[model samples]
Target: MSGSLELGHHSSLHQAQDSSKCLDEDGRTKRTGTVWTASAHIITAVIGSGVLSLAWAIAQLGWVAGPIVMLLFAVITYYTSTLLADCYRYGDPITGRRNYDYMATVQSYLAGGIKFKFCGFIQYANLFGVAIGYTIASSISMMAIQKANCYHKQGHNSPCHISGNFYTITYGVMQIFLSQIPDFDEIWWLSIVAAIMSFTYSGIGLGLGIAAVVGKCLQLHTCIANPFLVFTDHFASETENKGLKGSLTGISIGHVTQSQKIWQTLQALGNIAFAYSFAMILIEIQDTIKAPPPSEAEVMKKASLLSTLVTTVFYMFCGCMGYGAFGDDAPGNLLTGFGFYEPYWLLDIANAAIVVHLVGAYQVFCQPLFSFIEKCSAKACPASPFITSEIAIPLGSNRCYKLNLFRLVWRSVFVVTTTVISMLLPFFNDVVGLLGAIAFWPLTVYFPVEMYIEQNRIPTWSIKWLCLQTLSVTCCVVSLSAAVGSIAGIINDLKAYEPFKSSY
Candidate 1:
């Protein structure tokens, strides 16, 4: 292995100069290629498969509760992101010693190699799981579209017969095909196309849904009912189950006594995972950000703050409007929920858009995993014969192409295998919770705190500051415990079925 990536060792002036020269020669160091603009990045991060479930989550809560929860989640996300950004801003300049990976290096500093490796493995696993989740979500979106089309054609009032296994297979094939295509530059254009498609289809779908719902209400004016208000009363009157109440029994704030309140809180908290997912993306990007001068870092911080506020507003509006239209029992897929009251054309458009958006989002989500794989390959086999011949000897070859082909192949296999497992299990609510709890939450929440404490050389703290730190750690521990329990529940739920016994 090359000893070039020594942890905590500062780069020499000669090495730094060489790196600067290479960056200048390649034109990669310029701000021109960087897509760090606040608005654009925020929008890209915010718009994902999670949006499909946002309204459904809110519907579980009272209508008024959904947007409020989204707003709170956005605020919390922004604050966490800011903390991460601050850490990145103040961090030392060492290659592979920043961002999430930096957490491992930090742990090595504070603890030892064993802890570092363990933390690294967990964080990497979390990211890999997220990639699988995105793949599954995209596939499901496609299946939904297909089912909707089938219903329209047959004039059948029955529920569509498509299953999770079908979607899993379909998504796995699509991802493999997409992954084989070369050229990372093309992803930006693809993302833009997806955004446009999503906006157009969702816009049309929203219009049609509103029109139909309004017309139906006018025709049956006397019987017309507000789903939001109706559901609120129903939920309030309902008794809370021991299991659900037990699940939410302990918390500092927002603990619920009534079923309606509990439902609302659950819905609101469900979306929090999505918000945290987006924040994780931002944290990953921190490594690539050029170390601006102190003044520039301050400017970028301001921009980030503004961008976050804008995102919060957008989420609030979207969540509120969605809950208003669909009320409780909004379809797990937002497009489908709207489609229930919208015209065929609108549903068709929305369906197409969701599929496209999910494709792009999935790609973005997979980047860090790919990067990790690439790094591991570089260290393990710097000049693999197969990769050197097939990839590195090309006319426009870069050293990065020297990455081990075997590693890439293995990574792809791992992704496909896990995705298949996820598919064979359940889809929808359980999968979301399982993915978030088992993978996403630990990576986003627990790892960050550990990394920060490990990496930074903090001055001695006062008694009050020490108490505050302890409190913060306690909160993280509680959140992590809850998240784990939630995931275990989901796993139990999935295990109860034996639809495909012996398939594993």
Candidate 2:
């Protein structure tokens, strides 16, 4: 009787400790994330290869529409994001059952039958598309380094065509190893580093753009040598047709056909959309935060505001400067598109930073998919060791790394599939635009508006409801326009382009 009593005492004590340390208020694994780490993840996801295309986007829209469209997207994104953040829990912001991912939040408050399946398909499909886009983008940056070096030696006019195939495979190899990382929370350090890398390249692009404008002014012997004056004078001259600089109306009808100009302008909207997109992954990042006295929803709103502010500021600087430097002729990628060739070494550094940032951003966007696949597999076969087992590899000093076989094999296959698909398409700007157009309205605007209305029991046709619905409709039309323009661009490019055979 005494021995039995002692065993019961020990078991109760163990349970108490486990309950306190291992589980959060929601009875899930305790999350150690904070505002800073969450912000890092947001920055890593938001500022991607999309920023490199912003200059081209501006060049297509001219000085007026480019910055306006970008700012408009920023406001829309931040507003919708706060709505999504509030949906993190079903009934209440804090006490209710947490919707662990975006699809769960949708199913909780909205129709689940078709809507659930559709949400899952769209969310995961968008993530898959991002992986392909990053693959294409990183390879482009890699190729740019080699091409930059070649330009330094050979003349800029010389044919320095280099195949992106090798560089694409190289990136795939790196991702294969990084893919083995088990979960989103474990990759916090990588996200922080990637966030720093993002700032590095963006700042460099802005600096080079300013330098280019100065260099052009000196070459032209303009009356005003100041960079600011040069920009104003250049824009005025271009608008008046005195110089080949950009105009108030964007790429002229002479440079591109009337139809082509229209398509390019619409496509530029999609590029800006892509640059601002992160809503698809926002909830996933929110899942990493620990319980708050202030609640996860409150914390996420702050993070969203901070992230949007930082990204919008950087986007304006880089995009405006790039357009100011090259005018209507701004390249698709500011750095990799050879906007500044003479600063070969600096260009090389910026491109390298881009590759490094994309490597981490790809994992940031894909980890939720990995987790979803693993959860489904485990649910289907809970008893199988392959699905449930974790082999702890000893690292000496009483430490071991837990390795899961399924995570290894599945993530490897996922990376390889995306790599092959990237090689086939390899149309960077068109692909980015399509991915943005496909994901923006549904993931960023539509679902959030619907979910917020349903969650809060807002009466239909009321002022708030009508306003929200109007916003959703406007975004949907924009998405459709962008999709059409991107598709048209792809068709035009395909007239001479071949899969896996073209060189940059």
Candidate 3:
């Protein structure tokens, strides 16, 4: 038994060593398509569903407040991400584990037992949920484009609808097929091709759509009316009773008032939080990075900086160009149903992009869940059923059948249960808001505070530093309040929109 255990450990080490070699070779060669530079990965991560919704979200915040909020959120996101990265640097000592695993291991080492389990669970939960949500969203986008295309072909003026079940089934089947592909080396090339196609389709479609809208805008006599400048004129009337009048009034009094700007800034900050999933992706892929432990910091730093810059530029361009072109009517996702009527080629590209994006998202979402399940199952039953049965049972015993049956039943039940919940109550934006608010308070702000307090048992602060800490604490308190309020607002919105008759 000891010899078998040793053999298993040796095999695992061999695999890791081989993986490290592959990464080193891939990293060294620019042409070796296996390696993804951090910038590319960041761009791919950030330019997901957020780009589609930014315009609409910003519109809600108003023109002047929107861009400012985006910029502020970018800064806050960079800071928080740096903090997370720093934690990663501090936690792992010469083990090439990714930040997510490092975080889990660190918490386990430092806190132990339930605290470790809970942290690890939350991290996995968030990763799985976000990945699934991204896939679902991308699928929805694809369905929208398909429906739009059908409507256009049929010459129908009505909006199109696609069945959610159809999409889910189709996506699942594709994922299963993709999973069967054997080589990790091949996937990078596919990702690159997909990335290029996605970029081309999205860029051209968005450009043409924007040009059409801008041409229309230019034709109007009101071309001189800057949308940003018109905020004060429109703000008071639009938000008179929407609970923002006082805030608008204060903003009107002072252009650079910190208090007035803080909320808007934080809203942008929340956008950053929404985009922070990209950083999580880096952490997710940390195990695959080939760099030595000592060099991980430099690698991570370069990766984070490059990735952030790429994402920031993409976001800024999309936001600014999108707003500039469509103004108020610009649909959040550049591939809006309304825009399909404008031309055929642009529509086709958008449709193709949505399809590809959805496909990619499904792969990303399923891989992690599948990997986690495999790991858990392997831990529970380390020995192969054939080997275990041969060793433990009498020769020609039929008891092996019972164990196999139990394993099959258990796995089936687990899969079915997870599938049901995911299909029925798949939480997207507003539902996500509720979950995040509940989780974010404890996980992001409170947990960090507790961790810092527990880890650092010394008081080596000067008066100036102490004052700064106090101010920082004050900011966190205010931010927490705002987050809670935002959650409440989302809940109220949901309630207001609920049906008159409930089946329950």
Candidate 4:
């Protein structure tokens, strides 16, 4: 009896060890990312070439309104992202039952029929639009760097002009390969690097702007003799043409009417919302947090707050400084805009950082969409070899061939499609504005707030609920107004361009 009891105790101990090992592996496979890595991912998603536009955005709103609106968006985004983080817990907290992605959360909280379908469609569309925007921005960044290098080496009028399409196609093709990475967790390192790059260029740009301002105050004519300014001055003698249009400065408040100011303010509001937009991938990123995911909500809350604080400070600094430096004539893209011809090396570095950051941001937003499409593809072609289960593939046989072929074909086609669009509509800032206007309220405002109310079972007439409802309605109106304005702006831009002309 003693021997049997001793044997049973040892056997039970071994069983417990095995169970613990299984749990560890399961957790590892489930949530492969940590708090800081996830925070880096959030930062990468939020900050991008969008920051470049904040200066222009602030210009539209003037100094006082810009920072306030941006901070307001920051607060709203933080609260909604926290609501989303909390909803990641499916049933139990400590038990680790969780919804891994945004769609899953939507499916759980929102209704099934039309609501769920619309949610999924909009969510995926927003994410896809974001990826396309990144692709477009990456190409533009590359072109800007190339142009700066050429002008530095040669002259501004050098015949070495590279077509923007060339860079767009190049970056798009590169993304086709990079997008093949199967999981979000696999690219946390990329996000970290991208996040750092965002801060680096932002700091550099702000420093450069402040330096220019200080030099101006000290009447340092040497510092203001930038190639861009020289070009503007030289071209001013000629007829009014596209090349000679100089940057705008000052409030110029007296020049526009009240209606125009309100319209511009609405547009600026939309752009600010866009600058803060990252909700489509919030839950997907949150899912990367390591389990037991009961704490994912808290982790994500902290991460979102950290990212928001950093980005808001950075946005305010860049926007205010850039506006102060350039005044009303701030370029739509602060980096690529006119008057940046000098300091080729610094410009090149900043644009390169943007390119690298956009590459990672593209993947961060696209991975979820890619996963969704792949899943649908597998379901549709159930009998295809590429769609086989692990057990069916056999241990010794190579299963990667069919999978790789599918990835190559699908992702390449997607990249090519975006490349074509970028080439066709080379209006970079206008297109970004349109995308933001269309997607801002739907993804960033309505869905999150509504889902939060439903998930928490808050009464519709309650103060919290009514406040969010009013905000959602307000966002909707603002989004519509901005969309119309953006479309008009794009139309006006197109009138100046002949078909297939190299915008660069």
Highest lDDT among the candidates is held by which one?
2
**Please, what is the TM-score per model?**
0.70, 0.86, 0.63, 0.82
Full ranking by lDDT: 2, 4, 1, 3
> Roughly what TM-score does model 3 have, to 2 decimal places?
0.63
TM-score of model number 4: 0.82
Off by over 4 Å in 3: 1-36, 89-105, 151-156, 159-162, 176-194, 197-209, 216-272, 284-295, 324-332, 337-340, 383-504
lDDT of 3 by residue, 164-200 (tens): 5555445555654565332334366656655665676
Clashes of each: 1, 0, 2, 5
Per-residue alpha-carbon lDDT of model 1 for 197-283, expressed as tens digits?
Answer: 656655544443333333333334353375533323322222121011111122212432354344334433544465446544554
**Which stretches in model 2 have alpha-carbon errors above 4 Å?**
1-24, 28-40, 216-245, 287-295, 383-408
Q: Residue 400 error for model 3, in Å?
A: 25
Tens digits of lDDT, candidate 2, 105-215: 899889698888888998899999999999999999999999989988986787899998899999999999999988877898888888889889988888777666554
Q: Pick the candidate with the highest TM-score.
A: 2
Who is ahead in lDDT, 1 or 4? 4
Candidate 3 worst ten-residue window by lDDT: 239-248
Candidate 1: C-alpha lDDT: 0.52
Candidate 2, residue 69: how far the Cα is off, in Å: 0.8
Better of 2 and 4 by TM-score: 2
In terms of lDDT, which candidate is stronger, 2 or 4? 2
